[model samples]
Target: MQRIGWTRPTAKTMRDMLHIGAPIFAELFLVSLFVMVDTALLKPCGTTAIAAVGLTAEPINVLEFLFFAVQTAVIARMARASAKNDRNAIHAIIRGYLKLTLASAALLAVLTGVFAVPFLTLFGGTADTLPIAVPYFQISLLAFVCRRMYGAMATILKGLDKPQWSFLLNLIANGINIVGDIVLINGYGPFPKLGALGAAVATVSGCAVGLVCAVVVMRDQLRAREIRIPLSDWLRSTWRETRAICTEALPMAGEKVMIRLGIFLSITRIAALGTTAFAAYRILISLQNFAYLGAEAVATTALIFLSKAYANHDRKAAQDAFSAAMVYGLAFSSLCAVLFFAVPGFLMSCYSDDPQVLSEGVRVLRIIFLYQPFQAVALIYASGMRSCRRAGIPSIITTVGIVLVRPSLVYLLAGPLGVCGAWIAIMTDEIVRCVLLFALRGKMWRQFTDAPTPSPAVV
Candidate 1:
């Protein structure tokens, strides 16, 4: 009867999330690494092949980001419900989002699979490159529908405030990918000889595994439900909320689309410089993905706490979580930033055996590092915004900063400044978000905290 905190996180909350977040981070990092491994193995196949895979990745990232936007909307709803202790709603949200995600995945997979060849060709793959691209793209399209299930499951786990399970699944999934990459890409022992296709197969296989695991998890939870809840019920009850979430998500999706486009442009700029630069850019992007895992984890941590606090109407707790995240996120980001700049060669050195790739990549590493502090600020605050369900404003900021400003400058500057110019563009975009969000979050948090019957830290 004396529940003080609207949603009280147990000792298990931080611990579990870290468990979940870390593996998710590591798995993605490993997946990125597998690409590097694929490229490394494929390097001997020739530069044209590497460029083909690299080029195909841009549209793939765009596609994936769109799905991510949907997941974000679903996660926002789940987090809100978790905060409110609406357990019944939680189950329905899970089933509802599952239906939405599966239908979308099925349609997109078919379309992408059907047109895979042309899409890659349009991206710059030549006849020789197209052979590799086609198989790889075909594999990607098939596996990705299953991948969306993993994505949705992971989000549901996180939304349920069980980040640990999400992380565990990723860890297991990454392990699967890394092993498959080693064996399939290089044809270890008895594995049949396959090239880029092998790598794609391996990657898809790993995601499929994740999908199965996700299904098992869901089944375990719904042991009591006789049927996966009907679509009609969801439309009647949650269609409005789903629409509201998607409305918020559209800007966020647009912003991420811009990022994918900008990065695609950056890759194009690098490719224009020729093979060495393109290979280097691929490695650099992979490394950047690894480096930003910390930023993402911290941001996610902030988002969870904010969601819980806001649901409970606990302004003090929300601020506490926000303040703690900035300090932690900044400190962690600064450390990685130092590593990126101070010894980038060491970082670049991990993935490739080529000297030219190392040399070209190391040059822009520092520029990317410059954005780390700002990246931390922006991501953490953005997470807070997502929690507050004011995702639209930050979404606008991100779209302007990432989609519009960054790519335009990078495209214009690339001819003169080379690869480094494109990275500088990336740094600038992040800083813009940092400045803009910092201006907004504090003022907004004040409103929630200034309300009556102050939220108790513990229930």
Candidate 2:
């Protein structure tokens, strides 16, 4: 086959990635800032509130990962459909995944709300924190449906090469959340002070608004493309697409489950270190997540464009996009590491006034900063693998790192190294995952090229 024209890693393509990745970076960073704002604002409520929120994070992450798996599945498949010019397949996949995810979200919301106490208690929620944690968990869980809609629509836009639309929608959502945080958390003017619950309310409300905005943007995009699905056939198409989506999503979901479980175990260990230690971790983790925004954005772009490249059978384009994505991921993540090292104290101080908490937070931040680049490489490589429909190996590698090695290291090290030990466990996990996933990049390339052309547009 002649090397078909596709996006090559020329100056123009590089510029395209920057333009695509910049807003994605901002979007992710803004989302992280939601947690940052919550942690910072709730500090006045006392350390228990912070610990409560921190404890709830593990379970919430599991839910986010589930939806994220669905989003990735959508992007991986839709990229191919777009590349193949299969308008019908794209529409079917979008409708199927959106409906399936929203249904899952709604069920999840109810289950989490009903079992909020039991779930929080499993994470070492105490009497004092449970009162705060349970309400927050209940209200926040209800937002899962909204979040699912927002994430699915955003992923669809990305697959269609319309990332700016998602970015703009997310920016509006973040603005709403920040304003809501100020008003609800502090009882600005007439609003009553609701503490931790208020933070949950603001974030959930923001997600709901984001879903609405995303729908509006997506409608315009679809209309522009003149893509319309007949209502009578919608359910029939959705059911057919569901089977295909689930086949792709299951392995990724397993990977997410294992990773979240690892974090869950790590959180349990951190809780044993006491409220001050966990609180410090909460603050430092928020900062660490902020740093990871760049890597996440690059990984997202890699998945969409690389999938498109491969779907078009353009190996060189795939290679170029993957290379450019890794470079972008590492560059931004390394900069974050530098910032973390230079001003760890200031970053911690933003979240807490407690001296011991600040000391612990700074120590954790420095340790985590050292491993950010490794995480960047790992995320990009894994995303590339997934884009090529070789998700199984990456999923296995992640499962081992998160479910077995990391938690064991944490369990053995936390007693001796305190919060630093927990940080070391995570760093170790990132390094292992990076090495393993990087080694498999060639295999992924071969797997995609050597395999028979898939039926229709199923990823």
Candidate 3:
């Protein structure tokens, strides 16, 4: 009887996971904090403003998926290149994706801005919310290119095992956003109060600064010598790299679209429950983002390690890395669960003082906490599989849970259980995905460890 691969995480493995994961956790925490602060700043404007901003959340995430998909491909390729110490490949991947990110973001931003109202309405925006949401969304779209570029650079840094640089970049950007929200939203000093619109402006400003800083830092870090090439050859190489990125990115983008569609439907159902219910849902989601911060960090860290391990074909090291990531992710999720259970009221109060919102939020938040550990398991294992370049099964599993099962549960349950029912559906979806991913992980371990060294082309 052999022990499982994850049962044997070495001390150095644990140390490495922490070193990489801590900054990512901090970066995510800061980003979530800025969101909560932005929500709080809008409170004085009224619940409609909060709900209006929340209406744009899923849509914005849907837009971001394009950038994230490209970033994922960049990370995967860059990680492999890093493992092989192929500096030119790393530089080439960075250059190709930066161009793709900018062009795509610019075009998407224009289209989304042009059809802002229809887009918002499609995502469950009520008449009252649309007037506010439309302009806020359009203004926020100004940040899209900047956000995409910054994200591209950050992913590159992380893939190269330089997460601290990414952390610093986020810290500066989020700090600016926090201060800008305070000044612009409330009319501080020379700035006029613009309410929800102010939040959008602050976001644009922060992303712009982050993008500039990222470009400068990336240039300094790479320091690759310029190799003169024929113009035609350069264009050909760029196209080839871009095509490779799109090849890996398409499945990931499809997965994201399905997941966002499910969320869009769920939010629409919650919005149909009326403004107060929707506002409460928004606040709870923000708090839920906190719970996910560490899990995402662990998953990302595992992805980087696993990518390198796959390149090296070191099964034991890959196993140890996965083990450490799960341990850390579960531990952090348990801590968040305890907090959610212990002080649900206090957490909800930070965003809203309305009795109806607080009562509903506290109830659903308690239910939400129950799924954290399971959710952590699903995220980490799915990411582990993705690093193995076995993303198709995990993507299929996620699509089924999010696209089909979760939304169906929401539709069936929301009528009987109210907003709480929707959350219960979410929890059930996480549990289902967790169980499936666990089984898939076992199968992956058997195949991966038993197999001979894989070809570089496959890896």
| Candidates' C-alpha lDDT | 0.72, 0.82, 0.82
Q: So what's the TM-score on candidate 3?
A: 0.88
**What residue pairs clash in candidate 2, if any at all?**
none
Where does candidate 2 stray beyond 4 Å?
1-8, 42-57, 123-136, 184-204, 274-280, 352-369, 457-459
* RMSD in Å for model 1: 5.4
Order by lDDT, highest first: 3, 2, 1
Better of 1 and 2 by TM-score: 2
User: What lDDT score is found at residue 145 in candidate 3?
Assistant: 76
For candidate 3, list the clashing residue pairs, or say none: none
Candidate 3 structure quality by residue, lDDT tens digits, 286-381: 788877877888888988888888777777878899889988988989999999999999999987889999999999988988999999999988
| TM-score between model 2 and native | 0.88
Cα deviation of 262, candidate 1, in Å = 2.9
At residue 373, candidate 1 shows an lDDT of: 86
* Model 1 misplaced regions, further than 4 Å: 1-21, 41-55, 178-194, 221-238, 273-281, 351-363, 411-416, 450-459
Model 3, global lDDT: 0.82
Across residues 362-443, which tens digit of lDDT does each residue of candidate 1 receive? Answer: 8898788888888888898888878766777787887778667887887887778877777777787788889999877654
